[model samples]
Target: MDSNLYRLFGDRVRELRETRSVTQEELARRVQLSRASITNIEKGRQRVLLHQLIEIADALDAKPSELMPSPQSQSDPTMRRDVARVVEMLKSEKSRSDK
Candidate 1:
């Protein structure tokens, strides 16, 4: 995945988390991840798994789509494809979780 995309996603996560007054440690606890993991995620130094992305979004009280980088923001075709793929996976995961 593109570093820029990761950064953008991380930035969104941090922004949303902060807006909700949630600390990294609290978010990690809610998501069942370590605090260090949350730190790495917010720093864009970690590649979040598909399930983890959904979990993080849920923990932050956000929709998965809200946590992702906008496909239109990417100039690279590969990045757009990557984002699209993740969006599809998020939809699938959400449906399953909702069941």
Candidate 2:
């Protein structure tokens, strides 16, 4: 949780939604998603899909990059842990295979 992308994502979505004078319900309707889904996105509880992000940006007349997390947050510490765990698993599998 380096820098907690949750805040960045939540703020960005709320800003974009407000700028367009769009309600969460309205945006949800336009995007064909549930209002709860839009709410989660604004709250940063859910990650948006690439295609859905693009569509949301288009609907808001914003650039898709506007929704992206910063480079630092993109390379999250959790991701490193996940990669290390996967590598360890692969090494164990190889060792088992060799025996």
Candidate 3:
């Protein structure tokens, strides 16, 4: 995957984790990883395997697709907007679920 895509994926993970009020350490534990690994992953300094991606999504209570960045988001401004909109929607949904 493109580094930019990895960065986007990381950003999405951080957003979802924060929205769920989950700490990095907690997330790491859930994913059977170290806190430093979570930090590195969230920083886009570490690339995750496919299984790891699924594990992360499960840890966050999100779908794997939700954790992925749209391939076109890097090239298309409109797609980027769509991705941001979807992220915002997910945040809203999470908040509503908390209420």
User: Cα RMSD for candidate 1?
Assistant: 2.7
Instruction: Residues 1-99, candidate 2: write the lDDT tens digits.
Output: 434465566667778889889999988888899999888888778776545765676677776556555556665656545543554555456559879
Listing every candidate in turn, what is its Cα RMSD in Å to the true structure after a full C-alpha superposition? 2.7, 11.5, 7.4
Candidate 2 at residue 6, lDDT? 54
Model 1 stretches with alpha carbons more than 4 Å out: 71-73, 76-98
lDDT (Cα atoms) of all candidates against the true structure: 0.81, 0.68, 0.79
Candidate order by decreasing TM-score = 1, 3, 2
- Write the residue-wise lDDT of candidate 3 on 2-36 in tens digits: 68777877888999999999999999999999999
N/CA/C clash count, model 3: 0
- Pairs in steric clash, model 1: none
Off by over 4 Å in 2: 1-3, 69-99
Q: How does residue 51 of candidate 3 score in lDDT? A: 66
For model 3, which pairs clash? none
lDDT of candidate model 3 versus the reference: 0.79
Cα misplacement distance, residue 54 of candidate 2 (Å): 0.4
Question: Model 3 Cα displacement at 30 (Å)?
Answer: 0.4
What is the full ranking by lDDT, best candidate first?
Answer: 1, 3, 2
Model 1 agreement with the true structure over 1-99: per-residue lDDT tens digits:
468777777888898999999999999999999999888888888888878887888788777778876667666657656665776676686789889
